[model samples]
Target: MFSCSTMMHIPTSQFLKLSKFKPIPDPRCKTKVATLSMGCFWGPDSLFGSIKGIMRTKVGYTGGSEPDLPTYKSIGDYIESIELYYDPSKITYLDLLQVFWNNHDSTDKSSYRQYISAIHFHDKEQEQQARDSMKKMEETKSNSIQTLLMPYKTFYDAENYHQKYILRKYKIFLESLCLNDDEIKNTYAACVLNGYLGGHISETEKVRILDIGLSDEQLRYLEACL
Candidate 1:
């Protein structure tokens, strides 16, 4: 829960400059990448971004035979996927895989290739883990899972508008952040706020965010946005 006392002191004008409040990882911190497709990338982008350890999230098209670049309007044979950058010390790949399986209907078949469930593993280790996890899921259901396990390949970024779907709806918040196109797509603050707006953030996560040195005015703005 947000602390009411923390919401009463700082000036509102200070909160309007949100870039100052954006979280930045330590320069020496190590991060890992994970990419997967479980249908529309919008939901998963917000879902994964809500997790504490994720550094950034981006939605794109991948796992296709098309030679040209893919966009939402002309996706070709590609799948709608999201790529995640996370702090390994705080979250493991196995943790992300569990979240993936729990949130999407991996066992059901999709007529559209773009919406099919798949995991694009970045390395051999990830591939093995994904396969092992899938095997367990298959055993649990006593039926084969439809999700595909594929090696990492090209990930053509989606158009800017599709990047942070839910968060983009709040124009005032975006204006406050004063972010350009690239910043909006990759910034940590945008990632966290997107999850909050999508209703994926938990009370514990809310407290975690509040403890990140935000001023009183910023806390008020965030709670209001929520």
Candidate 2:
């Protein structure tokens, strides 16, 4: 399933009222962009969602010689990847490349088993670019970048149940966490989370309901989202 960045809900009217706070606007990303696989898509989606320049992101399967559709039950059968649609005005491919390096452990190749931790690159340019970016990161950040940058192949869309996982979980999670804000519907992002939270039982549902880890307000937030 796809991971999601935090999308807090705020009503449109109230959101406008609070616009004085200058919340980070959605990404200006406008091109068809792709990134290879990692262990999971949810966390990656969540991480990317945190960035301001991203417009939209999708989670799917990539790296196999042919298109490989990964089922939730068969998640292990495929490599987890993401396809991002972004506005070039907000973030550059170079910028997203940096994120790719930062988000996952891309330090070795042979050790990166293709069946499992194999990090594939979509093209020769992207492969080389990843290497170049790693070098730059090493020289400037005092560290080396390492990841298996393989070839571009095919990508298959995951099942519908797997899409927007975090959003769905966010709703149920908030209800369980009690992290609710009554003004949810007014804001786009938060509403997304709220819709998800309210719509389905999160993959983490059993544990959350079982754990007394939330504060009063957090519990309220969860309730509010639900």
Candidate 3:
């Protein structure tokens, strides 16, 4: 039996209907990728995923020196990081950089490499932008920003359990969507739902997503969960 602490009943048909719902991509939109490390990756995953322009968000390990694979328990020199895809037409890279700097305590130094705040820039332009942003931040605070600006090497996807960490708490909601682990990690719907469940989604984004073909039952369940 499907049960939750919220004790909301969802019909089987709702699940079936939601299973068919897919996000329609804009043909004209060119997506840009951003990789950021800010403490634990889970919170950043939810935070960035909630934004309207973000197409997908994935938590992973990057900028590590170790050759071995990095798991949560076995991370070598890797840092807990989040990589997200966003439509540049809707949101600029500078906007995401601002969000990254604003949300995390970049000033705090961490002894552990895995928890250090850093930006893994994909290109020269991004590297310059990150450096300029860091300079601005340092100027505003009148202190050196401890956040590292580095060239992005590779992103190793974290274990299945790490994806959509917050939204996974609600079993009924996940069941209704009928998505497997990979789908949950990649789908825009799951990303948005994860954001909403984590209380990161703004009202404007809420209204925008609500009008995106969600059934009445799904809408009610999402609202109730929030």
Error of model 1, residue 208, in angstroms: 3.7
**Residue 170 of model 3, lDDT score:** 68
**Candidate topping lDDT:** 3
Cα RMSDs, all models: 7.3, 11.6, 5.9
Listed per model in order, the count of residue pairs whose N, CA or C atoms clash below 3 Å is 0, 34, 0
Where does the lowest 10-residue lDDT sum fall in candidate 1?
Answer: 1-10
Of the pair 1 and 2, which is ahead by TM-score? 1
Which candidate gets the maximum TM-score versus the true structure?
A: 3
Give the Cα lDDT of each candidate.
0.79, 0.49, 0.80
- Per-residue alpha-carbon lDDT of model 2 for 73-189, expressed as tens digits? 554445667666555677776788777766565543323232233345666776777777767766755334444466765666666444544554443333342323322212224
Q: After superposition, how far is residue 20 of candidate 1 from its true place, in Å?
A: 8.2
Could you tell me the C-alpha RMSD of candidate 2 in Å? 11.6
lDDT of 2: 0.49
Worst lDDT run of 10 residues, candidate 3, spans 1-10
Better of 2 and 3 by TM-score: 3
Please, what are the lDDT tens digits per residue for candidate 3 over residues 1-226?
0011332232322233343344444234568999999888878887898887898899999999889999999999998899999999889889999999888888878788888999999999999999999988998785567899999988999998889887787666677667799988987778887788778887766875674556677777777666
Model 3 deviation from the true structure expressed as Cα RMSD, one decimal place: 5.9
* Candidate 3 backbone collisions, by pair: none
What's the true lDDT of residue 2 in model 1?
15
